[model samples]
Structures are given as structure tokens and as C-alpha cells.
Target: MDRLKYLLSPIKIRNMELANRVVMPPMGTGLGNDDATVSEALLAYIRRQAKSGAGLVVSEITAVHPSGSVSPTHLGAYDDRFIPGLRKYAGAVHEAGGKAAMQLHHGGRESFFLLMQGEAIGPSAIPSVVYRQPPREMTLKEIHEIIDSFGRAARRAREAGFDAVEVHGAHGYLLTQFLSALSNQRQDEYGGSFDNRARFVIEVLEAVRKSVGNDFPISLRLSAEECIKGGYTVEDIQTILPRLVNAGADIIHASLGTHGTPAGITSAPAEYEPGFNVWRAKKIKEVISVPVITVGRFTDPALADEVIARGEADMVAFGRQQLADPDYLIKAKEGRTNDIRICIACNQGCIERLMLEPGSSVRCAINPETGQELIYPRTLASTRRKVWVIGGGPAGLTAAYEAARIGHTVSLFEKEEKAGGQIFYASKAPYKEVYDAWIQWLIFQVQAIGVEVKTHTLVTETMLDEEQPEAVILATGAEKIIPPIPGIDLPLVCDAFQILGDEVKPLRNVVIIGGGMIGMETADFLIDKGCAVTVVELLPRSPVKKFASHGYMLHKRLRDGGGRLLLGTEVVAIREDSVVVVSEERGEEVLPAEQVVIAVGTRPRNELKEALSERNIRHFVVGDASGPRRIIEATEEGARAAWDI
Candidate 1:
């Protein structure tokens, strides 16, 4: 096998010389202290990524001004008071032999709860879809103040020992709003024409450059296209790129999408291929002389190498991929790609964390030690112990792997012949190939650590007694919850798991009784196979409404894919060839179908948990067996349990 090395090669930017090309892009972990200062928790979080061998660690999006903050817990570079904590953060990164950069941002109209306190400000007094708040148009005086704020923030970042400062000009933030024609409809010198719209960003770059001086690295994150209707396109960027470069941008970090609509910002359900946004980078690279960094679903190391080697991009940024495994670059450099935990792109953890649980830290579905570095340190105990993990699902696999890594004699048991558990069914859906990578990588990690994995074996008290392990972890997982609707026991009625597992044959017409993530994804797979599909959900909106902004984008794609969506509807009965549904607005409706798939919910598998309790043995229950939830919760719980052992 050819050893890939360029990803680990040294790269110089301005006066900062990086140890490698693996740059950790700015991500919002939401771990800031109450006073908007960088917390010890945040320091430990970045330290883990630095220790994992990233060349450059970009701090999470730090607000340049207080009103510019996306959330209350977000890090702020607005005041000099924050410098001491930030200095400590920079020292930690430097201690790990990794350079640090700070990403400066302004939330603009995207401000959530803060909008209620003060007027949301943007280039134009337009309302955002997500925030639904009308923003006050920024006056010339306010614009100048904000630009100065950015400069002051950059000066503070430099004083705090950051090697570089990246201006967050992408993702439809304040700077992006000034650059986008769709948002910036003002006829002043700051809006309307491309040059006018690009004026503010140029000023920001020039201000940052003047503040940080000629030797310091000043990177600008540019959105090649807004990816929305009437938004700036690649052609629009051609006129602005040179201006930004001339304004002293050391590097152009290119990305796409806006926060208003779901389009272009994320991979729609209809398009789930890997490296979906590389072409945007390639097009931007064609016009810019500055080194361009691009990231959007670039998971495969080979593909990352190809992008850099072919000159499509100077740096490949791994977002969710690096979240699942911070050591992604280290493992790739060592030819251990198979052992690297792959992000399944299940927004259940990343996106959902911010949307559903606001102010909580972001986490990964596969990697459990994400933002909980303080609570669960990566270092293992000095004494080795014997650990037994029962079940082969995500939680069980994670627990076993963590235990084995800490010099534990680990044994994992699964009743099924193969691993993955319920995730096996999840991967069978269309556009879920990323899940396969996660499963394979996790399995490889367990085996590589010399953990004994026994398939086709049911764990019981007898086996537990025979093993006499120091610690036992129960990750028995979950089972599909089938509602007791009339005629649900009919042979034509099946659950989503059965269909996904290939245990049930696809029908000519299918009626999915729930409009959640699983049901919608199943509908997508069935519709692609030429099966007419109808989704019935009892909630006012689809269950996917609980997903993150990006996940909602995917939900919209599924809705636009020609499938019948029956929201605020409940399934009352299931017939051999039809389903009876009831909705408040529609009264009663009969949906004709050859098969009915129940995807309402799932229940924890607690039979093994009961057995463990009866034995009075020292054990911990994690994953689905503890409760039915997303993979992120399961992985975190499992890793914590193993770490305790």
C-alpha cells in the first residue's frame, strides 16, 4: 500500500509555519463559560484535538462583539478581559505542538434569543426564516463600528498568542449578509452591485490585516455561492476574489450555504454522495491565487489526498469526520484508515445538539469523548482490568474498544452472527453508506486492540459467571415499537426494521405509519425502488422537525421527492391492502397500499438488564437497553461506563 504523507507535511502561511496540513476547521462546541470567556472545558476540548496531531486547531466561532454572538455560551473575542483565558487556551494548543487560530464572527439576524433583547442588525432590514425576527438595517456609523470591532478582536487574538485569525465571512453571518445580494439589498455603497456588496468584507480584511500587521496570517472564510435563490454565485465571487486577495487575505477558506433556507448549506436527502462540495472548491480555486481550503463531506482520506494532489484545494477540512475521530489525520498518516472511526453523517448528534438542546455542547455519534474531555479524560487507569461487553451495537462496540485501549482484557458478545445491531438496518437505507464506514472502522478498532469478539453467542448469567470479569457492560440495544392499531398483525403489515433488514419484501405501494427520520428515509429507499409511498404522522410537523438546521434541509428534500406527506394524521387501522388514517383537518382518509410499515418509535431491550440485576453483579447498562435514543447518547454513555471501569 502507498503511504500518504502530504497531509502530514509542513505548510507555511505568512509568518506561521504549521507542522502539518491537517487544519481543524472552526466548529461551535458551545462550551464557553457563563461570562462568555473560554472555559477550562473548552481548553481541554481543543487540547484533545491538538494532542490527536492536528497541525492547526481553529478555535470555535468566537463572537467579535457581544450582539454578534450566536449563543450565550459561545466564546467571545470582543473584550480584552477575555484575553487571559484565551491565552491559556493558546498555551495548551502550543504545548501539544499544534498552532492555534481564532475564528471571529458576527451572528447578525441569526441571533436566537438575543434578538428579543435587542434589535437584530443586518445590511438590510430583512427577516430570517429561522429566527423569524425582523432585523434593523445597519447605519453607516454602525457598520464602521462593527468593522472596528473585528479589528480589535483580531488584535486581541494576536495578543493572546494565536498564530492566525480567520474572519468568519461565510455561513450567512453578518459579513456574509453584507456580501450576499439576496440579503444585502441596500442601494448604498455597501450593497446592490457585486463590488458594493464585497466592499464591507474587503474593509474587514484590510482592517484585520492592519491590526495584525504584515507578518501575521490573516485568513478569510468565503462562501463561493450562497446556494440560495437570487444569491451570489461562483461568477459573483470571481469579481470579489481579487479584491479580497488584494485586501491582504493570506488564505481563502471556501465553503457554501446560508442559514435562512436549508438549500446549499447541507447535503439534501436527495444528494448524499461523499465529497459533495469539492466541485465548489475546485471552481473557487480556479479563480483565486491564494491557497483555498474546502470542506463538505470530505470523509475518505484517499479523496482528501486527491483533492490536494490534484490542486483542487490546498487544504481539506474534515468537519463531522474529524468529530467522529480527532485522530483521523494521525491514523491516515499511519495507514490505519480502516481503524479510524468514520462519521456516519447522522446529524442526530452534531446538528441536533444545538437545535434540540440549545446551550449544550456538540458531540459525535461514533466518538464519545467529544466535548466531555473534562469529565472523561482520554488517559486510561494504570491498572488493567477484565471487561465484558454484551451486545454488538454501537454502545457495546464503543465500550469494548475503550476498555481494550486501556490495557483491559475485553470480550464482546452478540447474539446475531454479525455486529452493527440496529445500525445494520439503518445502513440499508439509501444514501446511508457513511454508516457502513463507521461500523467497519469501529469493528476494526475492537479487533485491532486484541479484544475477543464472539458472534452468534447469547450472553447469559452462566457465561457471565464463567468469565468472572471485573466489569460488565450491557448494550443490548432496542426493538421496534409496533403500535396496537387494528389489523396491525396482518401479514402485509411490517416494521421499518424488517424492510431495512431485507426480512420483508418491498411492496408495490407502501404506507409508512410514521413520518420520523427512519420512516422518511425508508420512504426514500422504497420510492427510489419504484414503490409509491405515503407517510402519516400524528404530530403537527414531521418527527424530523426535531432535527438540526441541516437535518431540516434534508427533511425538505424528502418532502419534495414526490412522496405523499400526511402530517397531523394518525393511523387508526391497517388493512391487508389499505390503511385508515384520521386527521383533524381531513376527517378520515383511506390510503391504499400493499404494505404498511410501522416506524412510530422503539423500546429499550431490558431483558438482559433484568438478568444482570438478579445476579447482583457489578454492571452498567448503556445504549438502547438503557433507553431508546440516538447513537450519540449511546456512544457517550458507553465510553463513560468503560472509562469508569
Candidate 2:
């Protein structure tokens, strides 16, 4: 608070005064039962965020009408039956010294047709990849009925004791479809000019305002910039803002992208820089007299303060950031910044987990106790034991931290001077820089919980025998899969780990021997340093599997930066200054290269496993040592190992 002075300041929106400018914008949580009812799990998740020092906590999009719902059991406010649970949510937030607003959503063309139990509905019968088919255009009567539904939802939100109501008009909802000229091509009064295209939202807002009355507050979330070709630009939204504000919008929450964005990336991914929507939000702020809140990977408190001080937006909202650590702002306020669990923006847990499957609940890759706050124990000691964790990587750090927190005497050993193993190199990538903060938080947690840290000290079988710890955790991590290709050991040929860690210098012309996420990242990293690069991959859909949302943008960056991407290409050989590749497009070709970087795959380091076995030591292997996977899997293993021990 002392440092983020502007961010910690109070702000007034209509008649509702917030304690601070921090806002936790609504992010989907599949915590509710599939019957459109909130469960204790849902309430527990909200309790964490409400107490996170955010002034206003907007509830996840609650379906206003069942037909526009994404999931059959999605949270809803369409009927009076939902009021009690909604009231419980709002009361929980208020009791925790935070205000709550419920977002009334109708997915329209963006809803899943199967989940909705029918074809999706929209302003027009537009083809949608999201819905998996063309939608059924809403009838005039049905449109009016939806408007009434919004009013009813607002009325229910008010009855539920919500401080305010937000109409979900952004991220390709029914309202957004009506507002977009590309989708809404109706010949009636509902779709033509700006006023006609925006008519539905205006009516919904007016109805909501009337239902809630003038004293209560109303917010309208808008996709300020569609962030795609031939899409609604910020200038268009700037032109459309006044009509909405005049209609009834007292607060404007400016979001990014349309419904058509890949992976439903309503929010920016790790590849995107922080404050991704600030410029768009600032444009909206320029024309609107109401308070405007902007959200898109806003994890840094300093950036939030700068956004307010620079007059980009009235308030800054943290979506994934708040999910990663519910008490992010509070930790910042208390100057425990290092203790704040930073969001790495991997999206595997929060966004991907909820969206990957039909009924997966919300989870966090870094913080395992996110949605299970009520069930997980934060500080409890069932028993005490001496635990020795080998390797200082994320897995080991997490295990040591958890073990120490639960009253176990823990000691962590790192062969290198730094604790972070591959994490140190991973954080150096342009997009993965957030991992640096995450690594710091891991170290801080271990230190705070009194974990004995020993760096530049390699643990051996002799050391294990001498210490004779009750529990030993092996998190030795992984190494690059240096294929059995000729000239791979040459000085000019390096692996991605070496390339990322500044151990290898960028050359004028380089040929990267793989096209996975790491290879692509390294390719861009070298290209960013003014190197011409070519990346070859064995898989046809290489580099798109793991990082789907941001992979497209990085692909574009690679191409635009004069880097070549050859999928379905196999690297036959790596010479001192060239890479021979065989591809369908170009049969057998030798690409000239001053350097060849390898990022084909990884191999687990299980040597310690065998070493410990020889000594009859009771040890558990976690993270990459168990198998090659993501940080989510690795961290989960660490937490589990801590608990089991």
C-alpha cells in the first residue's frame, strides 16, 4: 500500500464507494453443481478472493437465460430459486469486507449447443466455431423476452444482496453479437447501424436499471477492442460507449478480444505483456464519465498503480492473478511481495482446466489450495519428521516449503549456486518472465517456514547415509534429449537450456533443431536478438499442443521476424554450421546455420533413484524425475509428497 499508493486509494462508482481501487474481475469457476446451483465449494472459492483485499469482487458469469448457457449446470440467476445461493455469496463477500457484483451472462452463439440442449441463439443465424454450428437467430419476441430476463436477473441479484449488477456484454455474448456488425446482420431494427446493432444491450441495460432502480449501481462489460482482423476496433467501441452509458451503464469494464478468439482467450496469455488492455481501456475512459475497470493478466501491483496514475483506467482488475494467490493485494500491502504467489500465466489450471473439459472445476497450477480453500489445510502438523529434499527446482522447493510448514524439519540441497534448476533458464524467456517471481515466492515460502537451504552442495549416497533422514525427496529434474545425431556435440550446436541461460550466444543465421514450445521460445528469443532462424519439427502440429492460446501469436512473431517454421520436418543431421532436414514441402535440404540449437525433448534424471536404492534409502521421486510434464503436475507431486511424508 505504501508503494502502490494510487492503487490502494479508494474509488467511487456511482453511489457505491470501494475501499480500494483493486478489483477481482469475474473468472469462470466450475465449482457449482451441474444443476445451476452453487455449492459450498463455490462459496469457499469466493471467500478466498473476497478476503484478498480487492474492493469489488465480481462473481463469475451467471446465466441470465438457460438457452444461452455454456454448461447445463453453470451458475445461474435466471430464476428466483438462485437468489438464496447468490445471497450467500454476496453475504460472504460483505462479511469479508468486500463488495460483490453478479454478472448476468447469455453466451448466445458462444454457448455450447449440446450443453445448452439446443442450437445456440444469437441476433442472427451466424456460423460459430464456439457453438460448433450456425446459431438460430432470435425472434423479435424472444429478444424482448431476453431483455426481460436480464431485468429479472438483476432483480434477483438485488434480492440476493449484491452491491451491484453487471450485464455481460463482452467476450462474444448475445449482447456482443448484437453489437458486432460481422455477426449481427439482421434486416430489422435490431441490426444495421450502430444504434440498431447496439439496441439489444441498450434495452437490456435500461431494463436492468429500471429493475434495480436508480440508487443501486449497474456495470456493463464490453470488448473494447475485438483484437482480430476485421473486428470491432477500439475506435468503434469509443463511438459505441456513449450510447451504453446513456442507456444505463454506471460502470464500464473494458475487456479484450471477441468470442471468436482462439481457445476462448478472452484474457491475454503469458506471451502477452502485462496491461494488455490498458490502451483499449484508456480509450474507453477518454469518452466515458463513469469509472472504467480494465483486466488482462494484471499481476504486478506496480503496473496496477501506474495504470491508475497514468489515467489509463480508474481501477485495475486481476483475474488469474487473484486466482493464483487470493491474498495477492494484501501481501503487496503488507510489503510481503516476495511471499505473494505470482501467476505464471500457464493457464493450465485456472482457464484451461475449466475450459478443457465439460465439467472440470477451477484449479491453480502454482497454488494447489485455490478452489479447495475450505478443504485444504494451510497450517496443520499431523506429525514431525526430518525431511531431506534433493534438487532446488520448483518440485524440491515446493516439497521443502510444504514439509517445513507442517512442522517437519526440512533441508533442501542444490548442486548449483541458485535454487531454481530449469526454472532459472525458463524464466529468462520473454514470455515466461513471470516465473521469476514465482520462483522467488517459492524460495520465500521455504525460508519463511524455516526450511534449511543448502546451495552449491550436491547430496550423495554418503551424505544420505550420514544424515539418515526419515524422508528423502528426489526432484533432480530433466535434461535435454541430445539425439544420437552426428555433430550434435560440436561447439556451434547447443541445446535450448544452454541457449536460454546465456551460455550460448546468438549468431547471424541459426537453425533450431526442434519446434516445440521450448524450441519456439528459443527461436523467438534468438530472432529477437536480430538473428535469422529456422525451426524444424517432427510433429505436424508441433508447438501448438501445450501452449495453444499464445502459440498462434508466437508463431506469427516467428514468421514476421523472418524466422522459418517447418512442421512435419525431421532433423536428419546437425553439422558444425548446418542442419539437414527432411520435410514434405522441401524433400531433403541442408539449411545453412552458424549455430544449431536443440530442443527436441527431455530425459528424466533418475540416477539418484538408483543411487538411493543402493543405500536402502526411503525416498520419493517427483516432478520431471517421475516423468516429463508441466509445472502443474510437478507442483502437485511436491504437495502430495509433503502431505504423504
TM-score of every candidate: 0.93, 0.93
lDDT of 2 at 126: 76
1-645, model 2: which lDDT tens digit per residue?
268989989977767888988888988888987788888999888987788879999999999988778886689998889988999999989988988999999988887744345567888887764545777889999999999999999999999999999999998778888988878999999989877888899999999999999888998998886666667888888887898998899999998777667534576778777887788888888887889998888888989999999988889999988888888887888887767787878887887677667688888888877876775666766778989999888889888987887789999999999898788877776677788878877887788789999999988878877888888899988878988888888888888988898987788998888787788888878878999999988988775553356576668778889998888998888787788888887799989989888898788987878878877777899999888777887887887788778
Pairs that collide, model 2: 34-73
Give the clashing pairs for model 1: none
Tens-digit lDDT string for candidate 1 (333-443): 777777677676666566556655877787776777787788774566788887889999989999998888777889999999998888887777666767776787788
Model 2, position 233, has a per-residue lDDT of 85
Tell me model 2's lDDT, rounded to 2 decimals. Answer: 0.84
- Global lDDT of each candidate: 0.81, 0.84
Alpha carbon lDDT at 73, candidate 1: 87
* Position 583, candidate 1: lDDT: 93
Error of 1 at 46 (Å): 1.3
* Range of the 10 consecutive residues with the lowest summed lDDT in candidate 2: 543-552
